[model samples]
Target chain A: MSYKQVIYTTAPDPAIDPSLTTGTFRLNTVPKPTNVPADKLLVRTHYLSLDPAMRQWLTAKRSYIAPVEIGAVMRGQSIAQIITVGSDLSSTFQPGDWVVAYSGWQEYAVLGAKEVEKVVLPPGGRPTDAMSVLGMTGLTAYFGMTEVGYPKEGDTVVVSGAAGATGMVAGQIAKIKGAKRVVGLAGSREKCDFLVRELGFDAAINYKDADWRKQLKEATPEYIDVFFDNTGGEILDACLARAARDARFVICGAISQYNAAKPQGPASFMTVISQRVTMKGFIVFDYAKKYPTALQELASWLSQGKLKRKEHIVPGGIEGAPQALVDLYKGVNTGKMMVEVAPVSEALNAKL
Target chain B: MSYKQVIYTTAPDPAIDPSLTTGTFRLNTVPKPTNVPADKLLVRTHYLSLDPAMRQWLTAKRSYIAPVEIGAVMRGQSIAQIITVGSDLSSTFQPGDWVVAYSGWQEYAVLGAKEVEKVVLPPGGRPTDAMSVLGMTGLTAYFGMTEVGYPKEGDTVVVSGAAGATGMVAGQIAKIKGAKRVVGLAGSREKCDFLVRELGFDAAINYKDADWRKQLKEATPEYIDVFFDNTGGEILDACLARAARDARFVICGAISQYNAAKPQGPASFMTVISQRVTMKGFIVFDYAKKYPTALQELASWLSQGKLKRKEHIVPGGIEGAPQALVDLYKGVNTGKMMVEVAPVSEALNAKL
Candidate 1:
């Protein structure tokens, strides 16, 4: 018997093909492993996350992480269920244990025990939260906002890509942390409405609207004190123009300009000097030592229903992973976007 | 008797006229003051400081400060001598006392006693040092380099506009603060040579050279850890590209883009995220409470001959103020550029 796995077929120049059908990736069937290594475990992937950062991993350029090489398994994080425990780790690990790992776009993975993080779900957290709210996505939002943005109580916080996974979480975190007025920039009216109506954002601007720039000006009458930028383009320029004195810009992701051969910087960047603003960029991994403290607070907010999460989970397993990633860049998904690679077995006694 | 004063005659849009012949300003003949108000002192301008920030005052645009209004004496800082003291200020200010005041581009000014800061020359400091190293130019470099850049002992520092008053001081401060290497970006070969041989920079790159970017790359082989940027353009982009992890960018001034209607942002600004860089902008006035501490240290360095200052004095008095300002934007001045309005009165008891 064989198992399916997606392989990166080409390293795109400047930008990856947003439409994955251009032969940039190939779904290959590989023979199933007959045995697990003594220090490893055999696991079956349940859900594979689709993220904007995946675009950077497709190019042979220097970034936070190395690019996924051609003919290699596409890099991704996934929630998996342990199918077998290695002989050397039978006492510590058991079959049916749920763990989150870099299982990539594959049905099955053979991984060392240290390569996988055992998932002990907090209260109100579902299994999917391991790949969404309680995982890297939540951690990115947490550190990027609290540590870098440093939003004061009276700060008017503006979040771009507000309907997406990390962005929605960042905006919600801002509101929970006592931001005065939370404004969101989304790509569509539905997302904007969802941000305001469902997520408790004070206002939402659909960047697609013709009068979007005007709307931004009106929304930020006091000027933006804290800006958590996920998309960097004209929206970044507009935000820079209205930046309050000593505004803090948390540079998280530039989803809008990721595909451009020559990305344009914000035209109003000089405002950084005029307004005495500070722009800082950071990676979530930098705060790994403090993750427990952050997660404890995030879990409390989630358990109290103060923090809510929205997910756009794509079904049809690994085959849909490519298009799901493509759609991620297109802003087609609201909140966390992931592909359901497989279903958990009834025998797995996990509570979540 | 009449006095000559330069008045802003017209406001230019997009970009200011680098040529004073464009009639943006006019030399006006005004009557000499007959009397000083009770709270004012009649002053004779001696030395007028010309700065790149003057360009911002030429346009009717919002900035850190209000623009110079049409028909007003063009705003400037000058060292002046008290010629006559008002009755109310007679006890506090004596004739021939030297002071630094915003006396503008005029041969004489009637200023409030509070408007002028009495110039008490420090040991081994000359009268010109009041407007150069010990004045706003030096203060800007002090806080901007120390507080904003935070150059570490092993850090590789880079300074753009490194030949200018503020930039040269910032680079030296970085060296004094124990930076491992200091690289300077200058416009001309002469300026570049002066930065290395005269000011003791580790290396200097002439940005006007065709292979300047390559030179910058070679000079900062360890990568730029602290970048004090005074000129914002391709130079900023190059520094961003060569930025080391967790680099600090002190955005002091953008003389290169000051004249542009649409100032371009750094194209490689994404490196801010990739390398976790921090870019902060500031005004020297914000640190007014700490000015005494900064000035004391600067004066100490000056007295020990550790800190050096170079001034390009245009000898043709107030009549040349307009063209001197135009030449300033062209980067013709190597260090602190000032116009000598009049000879300091020998009656002044101020120490040299």
Candidate 2:
């Protein structure tokens, strides 16, 4: 019997094109392991997450975490099912249990019990929610907005990459936190409309438009009090120019510059001194201790329909993940991008 | 009698050359005023303070304060002596009393009592202390370092424009507040040595050197915990590359970019995210209500010799003021730059 896993090969050529023969990643077939260690379990991957931060992981440079080494299984997070339990773990043994783990891009993985976190679904929540709104993405939006951005009542809040997973939730959170007006920036008219009509954003601007800068200026009449930036290029520069006195800039990610060989900084960065702004950057993992309490609130909001979810799930198994990731850089997904490697029917049957 | 005042004539031609026949400013002869209003006092200018921030005031753009209008007396701060007291302010102000005011560049002026702050010298403190370490420049360093930078014990601090008025004090304050090592960046070897030897900086790098970046790296083995930036250009970019995690960047002045037709930002600014850095900008006047307590503490430090003062006084009177202003942009002064418009004989005589 055999299992398949994606292996990292070459580094990015400024921008990633996974279809090339000498691309950054390639799929490899390997013999399935027949043995599970006494303290380990064998699991089958059901869904694998694809995110913008994964691009940062491909570069051969130092960051919050180490870059994925060549010839290694590509790094990832996924929902998986227990296929077998170890003999020494009989007390806590579980087959057919659903859990989340950093299992990488593979069909099956052998892991110790401590390596996976058992998923306990909230009322009216789905298993996929654990990989998104009730998981790291949701937690990032919660902490970045409330803790770093500090959007106040009546403050004009602006968010870039507003249609993406973390940004969508961050924009909605600003609204729930009592911001007077919330504006979102996206790459297309449909995404803009979806943000305004579906996500309840007060206004949404298509940054790809020729008059986008002017549109941004008109949208932020009182100026941006809180700017949650995920795309760090021209949009960040424009926002910096329109920053109000004592504005707070929460730099969550820089998706726009991730592919560039040499990323450019905002030209209006000097406005920081003139306007007395505070620009801070953070990684979501820093708030690990507060995850549980945050998930409860996120789950509550999802149940109440105050928060919404959009999943762009591809279904051709692990093979589709690399192309999906490449499409992500092109703004191809409306929301969270994921690849379904195996049938989630077991969890769905249990839910019923 | 006619008194001289430097008049702002034209906007900067990218850079100011006060010697230009058609320049940013010109010396104008004005007839001396013969009358003093009941609510105003006549004062003779002694020493006028020149600062980098004055350049920002020359541009016809909206900022924290209105720009100096064309054909107006170039704005300045000065230590002056009251020549005659207003009828209404006789008890509050009298002849021979030394005071500080935004009295502009001129020999004499009439001002309401409210326009000037009374100067009360601390024990063993010189009257010039009011123009440097005990004045606005000192307050800028205090509030910016303590409230913004928040340098912790066992931390490394780096300061640019390290020999200037605010940066010198800011670097010393970091030391007094218990920073383990302090580094200073200046344009000349002499300024660097003065900083390391006389100002107690642990290391001083002359930024004009070809290997200054290598010197900076060798100086900060622990990386920069706090960066008090006074010159914002390539120096800022260099500091950003060596920033420690959670470093605090106090954005004070950007003298390097003050005259650029198009100021460039730090190319390595993305490190703010990778390192979870916090960069904040502030103005000293924002803490006006707390000035009294700040001044008392600063005076105590000066009396104890924990804080030092240095002044570069130009002595050809008001005529020397224009070229002095031009030389400021060239980093001519090692410390606080000022012009001695009139003798301090009256204040000195009163002390006897």
Candidate 3:
């Protein structure tokens, strides 16, 4: 069988601005991966998670993970359906099982058992949630907040990029954890409205406004206690300026600077010293051992109607993955940006 | 009785380069503070500690501590001898007892009993050591290393401002803690030599050299596991680039940016995210409870000749305190920089 795949062709030019063209990835028709080795399973991609980390994966620079090699399928995480299982791993993963895996930007992947996690969603939970709130995004918010941010009751928590996938969930979690105030910094007025009106953020500041700094100060009257920083640039500097004494600034993601030809540091970083703040940069993979507990709690919150889930699903299967990533960088998505290659069964959609 | 004191007259112009004139402090002669209130002890300053923080105190801007008001004595830490004890506190302190106190840039000060800690130097220890290796500098190094930096055995620990008060002690502590390669960044070849020869740093790079960054990379070939950053600016950016995975950056000071009109933030701060680093800025006051333990351990090290002590003592009484601070900012001092206002008794000086 033939399937579609996105192949990385060349490294991006850092001198030029990052865009769809910066990714040098091309869609190609390829034979579906077959000959599953012993202890491996053959899976078909259903939904591909379009994340900001994809930008880093395309760069030649060393990061937490290696750069995707040229002529290889673009690296990505996907919700997949097991098509065939090798005899060695037949008991662990049988045909028809739905799982989340590091399946890359390809329709079909032959993955070892360890590469995929069998995602068991609750009743009425969508498999797509596993790619968003129930998977890496939600878990990233959970551990980064509890472990690094260390929010306390009556603390004023400020989150940058608060309308994005991890940011929205992080603010909600801060609110749920008894934070006195949860202020969000988003780009658009609509996203700000969604955060405060729909997502329970105490207040939201439109960072694109000329007086966003003033808005941030007005919103966080008592100063910030825990700062969940997703966008790292001027917004981060503004947040740093208002940081309370001994504030914890969790460096979850720096989406704003990821594409910059020369990423400028926060100008108000002096507050990190004046306020004696702890700024920690972390990767969610560092907390892999605690993912189960985080997932269970997130699932509980979702079932109880305490947590909301949203996804901006792009069409065109594997061909849309690259463009969806560009849209993510442009802040066009309100929630988890994903490319849906194959739809789930009507029964599964109805359950959700 | 007449006494000499330095008074801050105005805030400095950040746009102008900082000099002795930048600090609008004037030496004044006034009647000694003779009326020791109940619960207070009158102290005659012996060694006035001139710290980089004194520069911040001169500014009207908000910091960890309140700014020294115009016409008020310049704020400083000092080693002093009890001159006259108030009857109410006669049991706690007596004349001729040596202590460390927030005596400011003055010849005499009336301080409450709680404002000072009695200095009980080890046998054969100099009273000046109380203002350096066995005092706040040592304490800053101890907690910033053990609590924040958390240098492990065989870890490459890099320290900036290698020959300064806190940096020297911090690097030595890293060595004492069994760090594999302890590298230092200093301003001059002499300071670098002192750090390597006298202070036991594995390697010392003169940051004033044209190829300092390259030297840093070479000195820390395996990259830095822990970075004790004292000089934050371009040197900090260079160090951040060589940070190892999960490196801990203890932000003890930013001496390099203290005088800048607009301190530039470190450009390579994204390395914090890529390397999963924890950069923490701390004030020594936060670890007040642990001072006794730190002091005892540091004293033990000094007594056993494990830790070396160096002091750049500026003479000419309390009048020199202002100029000594300017010298501190200029990186003229090799170790602790202090102004010796009054001569210590012949008996105390003999102990050196």
Candidate 4:
């Protein structure tokens, strides 16, 4: 069998430009592995998650995670179906079982049983949800808000990149936790409107608007108690300027700075001291032990309709992974951005 | 009776110049406050604490504490000897009692019983010790290290402004708490020597040295775990680059930025996200409730010789307050910087 894969070809010169292109990654066809190791399972990708962190992975510098080396299949997390199980792990995973795996930007992936997690989906739920709201993005928002942001009752919580996957969920969670007002900042007016109308945010400021700072000031009249920052740049500075005493800034991701030739530091950073604020940066994987409890609460919220999930699905299979990531860096996605590789088997869907 | 007082005449233009000058202050003789209010006591100032926070108080901006209004006495925390007490508070304080008071840059002050704290000295201890080792500076170092920094037994702790009032005490406290390596950054080689030899810091880097960054890299071989930052500028950026995962940055004071017209933000601030670090800014006032216990522990350390105290005593009494403040900003002092406004009364010394 033949499977399509995206491979990292070159590291971008952060000093010159950091635009993602086919020159940096190449599409290739390769023969699928014929024999799986006894402890491994073979997964056929259905959905691949395209996140801002992928841009960081393409760089040569050391970060929280290792860089995607040249000539290597690009790294990503995906929801895949176990097409075949090795004899040693046949009792653990069976054919047609859906799992969340670090399957990378490829149509097929071979993984050890420990590398993939079994997805326990709700009735009538799609497997794609397991790669988004019930997976890494949702868990990122969960721990970043509750643990780091520590939004208190009657507090005003401000979320940047509010229309994105994690921002949308983080704002809603703050509201559910009794935040008096939840304000959001998005790149476009339509996304801002979606955040306010669809996600039930108190107010949404279009960062693209010339009067966005004024809008943010007007939206958060009492100053922000917790700022869940995903886009860290001018928006982060504006938020810092209006931080109340002892405000908590949860730095989940800096999507705005990810693609910059030289990431500009926030000018109003001194507000971290002047306002006696606490800014904490964290990764979702750090709280792996607490994932089960987080998922249970998230699942309950989904069932009760207290939480809403959104995903922007790109139509092309594994070959479209590069453009999907490029579009993500351009702030083109409204919610979770994912590339659909294939449809899950009816048997797997029915079993879930 | 008459006493001399320093009054703020004008605010400094931080953009043009932030040097402390007598041009912004004037010394004048004033009648000593005599009639104590029903709940107040009359106190004679002895040792006036000149801190970096005083520079912030001169600026007409909102901070953790209100700025000193122009034409008002310069605000400060001081060790004073109570001279008389109101009838209502006679039971709580006596005439010869030493107390820590918000006495400002003056020889005499009238304060409410609730506004002043009685100083309890160890046997054979001088009243001057109360202003340095067993007072606000000591308390600040205690809480900022234990509460915010939360150093572990084998943690690599870095302290900036390592020879200042709070920094000296903070570094020692980290050492006493069993930190495996305590590295310090000071402005001069003498201060660095004092930190390493006198205060027992494992290593000290003279930030004024041409190769300070190289020295810091060599000193903190395992990267910093808990960074008690007192000076925030390039030193902070250098430290951020070498921070360990989940490192704690206790922002006690930004003495470097205190004088800047526009403080420069750290360029490597993204390390906060890349390393999953937590930077917390705090004021000593927040831990007021726990001061007594901190003082008890500090007093015990002082008596046991586990902690050493040093004070740069500027002479010329109250008339020298302005110059003393300027010298402080110039980094002329080694440890606690204070102006010796008045000598303790012979009667008070005999009573103790």
What are the Cα lDDT values of the candidates? 0.88, 0.88, 0.85, 0.86
Q: What's each prediction's clash count?
A: 0, 0, 0, 0
Candidate 2 scores a chain A TM-score of 0.97
Docking class of 1: high
Candidates in descending DockQ order? 1, 2, 3, 4
* Residue-level lDDT for A192 in candidate 2: 97
lDDT (10s digit) by residue, model 1, range B145-197:
99999999999999999999999999999999999999999989999999999
Off by over 4 Å in 3: A15-23, A33-40, A87-89, A345-352, B15-23, B33-40, B345-352
- Model 2 steric clash pairs: none
1 or 2, greater by DockQ: 1
Give the C-alpha interface root-mean-square deviation per candidate: 1.0, 1.2, 1.2, 1.6
Expressed as tens digits, the lDDT of each residue in A191-308 for candidate 3 is 9999988989899998889998888889988999999999898888888888899999999888888878888887676677778999999999989999888999999999988888
| Candidate 3: residue pairs that collide | none
Per-candidate Cα RMSD to the true structure, in Å, reads: 1.7, 1.7, 2.7, 2.8
Query: Whose DockQ is greatest here?
Result: 1
lDDT tens string, model 4, B219-306?
A: 9889999999988888888999899989999988888888787776676777898899999988888999998899889988988999
TM values, all candidates: 0.97, 0.97, 0.94, 0.93
Model 1 lDDT per residue over A231-322, tens place: 98889899999999999999998898887889888878778998999999898999999999988888888888888999998988798888
lDDT of candidate 2 vs native?
A: 0.88
What CAPRI-style quality would you assign to candidate 3?
Answer: medium
- How much is A250 displaced in model 4, in angstroms? 1.5
What are the per-model DockQ values? 0.81, 0.74, 0.68, 0.56
